[model samples]
Target: MFGWLFGRRKQEKFFLEMMKAAAEGEGRRKLFEAASMLGIIIKGAGTDEEKCAQIASGLVNNLLKASGTNINSNEDDQFVAALFSVIACSHFSRILTSQFELSAMLSWVILTAGDIEKIEISNQATEYYIDMTERKAPVLIAAGNSIAKWVNQPTAENFRAVVNVFDHCRSMVGYA
Candidate 1:
């Protein structure tokens, strides 16, 4: 039956429950579920811009609290890192481009993780900054300045990656 396949009402209920769990801090299960939902939303077919922004905002707000407890705890760190990875992924970059809050959240995630040599997250954040610079150069330039502070200059790769992002942005503007 179509109902068996879709289970639309059940899906809705599940989503609502997940949202409640995210808000109530029902522990790692809820946090992980919320993070997974964000990944799905970012990677899902079609571009529902408004819906994506709303969901991303909610995820960012919920995870902010989760990040504060025991940064050195592997369990906590992994959960936060997974959520950060989801937010920083390429798919998420597109979903977040139109939303200032989501972009800011992505920047925050990168800055927060940079100290630990989180190259993947940093790369994604740089890519986002590049994309945003192309879309709204002035806004991203200002944002880039803030992101600049997070770079670990002692890490050659990280320094080069940041430079490359700026270079790429410059080249795009030159052609335009």
Candidate 2:
């Protein structure tokens, strides 16, 4: 799987550049580019699911925390959420479910949902959330618990976002 993806030196270089772009945290443009590449790579990923999952986790973490990132653009945020959906729909979902810190992904969905007025990004985030929750209910519940306080702050829109996130987590975990 690794060999096929990186078989060509050019492909290797592109991967490295994408990683560099993701790491620099200079702007959302490069992070978006890296995310685009991640979608492609994940879609074509073969065996060696472990490696692919690790890559996904790292790429996701970097993208979410990228310095100067505004997460305000519908198009840019959609791409990132779509990447999560891509992995969710693939065999890689298991790795993501079992090993990743999905709270961050969930946070992204919540935060981005609040920032944008469009439905495209929200739809994608919903897809990813449902995908992860189906396979990792316990993890989702625990993660939700940890962040629920922060998300449910009294001053934050009266906790509408927290209610939404908690409602989803509960429904997924059979609590609602």
The prediction achieving the highest TM-score against the true structure is 2
Task: Write one digit per residue (lDDT tens) for candidate 2, span 77-174.
Answer: 44443344333323233322333334334334444444445445546655665776688856445444423332223233423433344344434434
Candidate 1: residue 158 lDDT (0-100): 41
Counting clashing residue pairs in each candidate, in order, gives 0, 0
lDDT by residue for model 1 over 69-141, one digit each (tens)?
Answer: 3323343343333333333332334423345444544444433543454444444544655566568766355
- For all candidates in order, the CA lDDT equals 0.41, 0.42
In model 2, where do residues sit more than 4 Å from their true spots?
1-68, 73-117, 137-139, 151-176
Score every model by TM-score.
0.22, 0.24
The segments of candidate 1 whose C-alpha lies over 4 angstroms from its true place after superposition are 1-61, 64-70, 87-92, 97-113, 120-176
